[model samples]
Each structure stands twice: as C-alpha cells, then as structure tokens.
Target: MSRIWDRMSLNFLSEDISVKSMKRSKQKTNVLLISAVCLSLSACGEFSYKRGASANDFQQEKKSCATQHKNDADVDACLANSGWIVVSADKPLFAEATTTDNKMPVQMTSDDKVIAEKPVDPLELIAVGSWWKTGAAPNALIADSEQCVTELGEAHQTRNNMSLVTRGLVGCMSAKGWFALKK
Candidate 1:
C-alpha cells in the first residue's frame, strides 16, 4: 500500500509540472506573436503629395495637367510649380528646423546673411517617398541613373570623392515621370 501511494503522488506531481511548462511555452509564444504584429503595423504607412495644399486642388490640377502634357516630366513640373509637395505619413512633411517666432531661418556666415537652406528638390523628395512605398533596391535606381550623368563627361572618381550624382539621376527619372506610388 505504501509503495502504490508513493508512485501515485510522483505521477501527479510530474503531470502538474508538465502542465505548468506548457502554459509558460504558450505565454512566450503569445508575447512573441504580439510583438511581431506591432512591428508590422508600425512599418505600414501610405504616401501622399500634399501638405498645406488641398486634395481637391491637386485632383483638379492633375486632371488638367493630364490633358495638357503628353510628357510626364512636363506634367510633374506643372504640378511642382502649382505648389504640390510630396509627403509621407511616416515622416514629417515640413521638417525644416525653425525658431518659435517663425522668422526666416539662416546659418551664420562670414559675409552678409544668406539663407542656410534651400527647399529640397521635389525629385529628391519623391525618391525618399518612393523608396518606402515601393521597397525597391536603391542600387538598381542608381544603375538606371548612369545614363543621366553620361552627358556630363569624365568625372574623376576617387576613394574620398565617390559621388552618386543623385541630382542628375532623380532629374532624369522625374523627366521620365517615374514617380513612386505609396503602399
């Protein structure tokens, strides 16, 4: 009778340990699943081409431009001139550092006052916007951009002077109407 009682108690304790272990495993799995979901949601966002501008204005201008220009570059220039700016939900639309007083921000210079920053080129803005939207390889874009800088002729590349020629490349793409769509 003593031997049987001892065996039964041992089996019950082992079963309880197994159940506790299983619960812990499930808890760990649930935590990991929740973390993964949060990470994915954070990465998700959309792109837009307006900040201070109205959507109705964009649509109307876009419709007119579509009818007017056969070339995408021409259309883009028209939109840009009309004050359409590229913006992303994930990033600040107007990230320009400014003082609270809203004065023209400038960098100290040796000479007379000069504006420290110029408005970022629309083409370059679109490049960043498109990257997040399309998830395309930047190397591929740079490869495609080689043709754009070919006209410049014979830039000496050195270890310290490695240049992407971004302006020329983005300009070429903009001329081709290769704007990135948001995901």
Candidate 2:
C-alpha cells in the first residue's frame, strides 16, 4: 500500500511538471505570433507610401511641342538651344540641367540617336531658370514652365529637385523622338 501511494504521488508530480512545461511553450508561441504580426503590419505600411505625380496633375500641364515642332531633330535642337545639355548621344540620350545656385543638377535624356551636342554649365542653367520656357523661342525649357520656379523653391531635397527637372527634360526629349533612358 505504501509503495502504491508513493508511485501515485510521483505520477501526480510528473503530470504537474508536464502541465507547467506545456503552459510555458504556449506562452512562447503567443509571443512569437504577436511579434510576427507587428512586423508584417509595419512592412505593409511602408509599402503604401506615395511616390510619383498623379495622372490628373500631368493632364493639366502645358505641352511644349506644337504640331509644327513635332519633327525629332528640330525638337532636339529646340530643347538643346533652350538650355538642355546632351549628356548621352546613345540610343537614349542623357542630359542634365542645373539650379541657379549651381548646387543642384537636373538631368534629361533622349530615346533615339543623338545628333546635336554642346557643353553646358549646369549651375548657370539653374540659376537663370532657363529650363522653364515655352513658344518658338522659349527663354527656358521647363516641362511646366509655370511651376518651375515655385517647385524648385519648395523642394526639400535639392538632389530630388534636380531629378524632377531631369525627368521633365527627358520627357521633352522623348517627345522629340529621342529615347529617354532611365538613369
């Protein structure tokens, strides 16, 4: 009887230990699940951040090339003469413009064979704000001449502003039959 009682007590203690270990395992699993959920939520939030211009915003801007200036070479010359510097004459011509401070550099590119070439002062281009012009003899060649000065002043990152200018110039170049390459 004594031996039986001792065995029963040992069995109870073993069962109690098993229950405690199981509880600990469950708690660990819960912690891991919570951590995973939090991490996934943070990642999702980051993926949803805004990046580029809106479709409607683009429609509102005035286009540079009129029906007459649609020829590729003529368009290229028009842009180059207006202040866009040809950086690459390859399949996609690359070019850059500068801010008035000469501190920021905005680049542009073309899609097809590069014909015209010229050396440009990026700093002087930006300082004078010549990239923002329209008409046959535009003073400057801005994608949206109306907003060039305002946007540059409001831009927080000078480099980013440069990039925006470069993109606009590339688009103008592409319109002129020059393939604008992604930098």
Which residue runs of candidate 2 sit more than 4 Å off their true CA positions?
A: 44-183
lDDT of 1 by residue, 1-183 (tens): 999999999999999999999999999999999998677545655223654657677879878987989896787667767756534345554222122355765666687865455654422322233322135466655544455456432341111112222333444544544443321
Per-model lDDT = 0.52, 0.43
Could you tell me the TM-score of candidate 1? 0.27
User: Model 2 Cα displacement at 163 (Å)?
Assistant: 42
lDDT of 2: 0.43
Ten-residue stretch with the least lDDT total in model 2? 125-134
Best by TM-score: 1
TM-score of each prediction:
0.27, 0.25
lDDT of 1 at 156: 16
Tell how far residue 151 is off in model 1, in angstroms: 70
The lowest-lDDT stretch of 10 consecutive residues in candidate 1 is 156-165
For residue 36, model 1's alpha carbon misses the true position, in angstroms, by 0.5
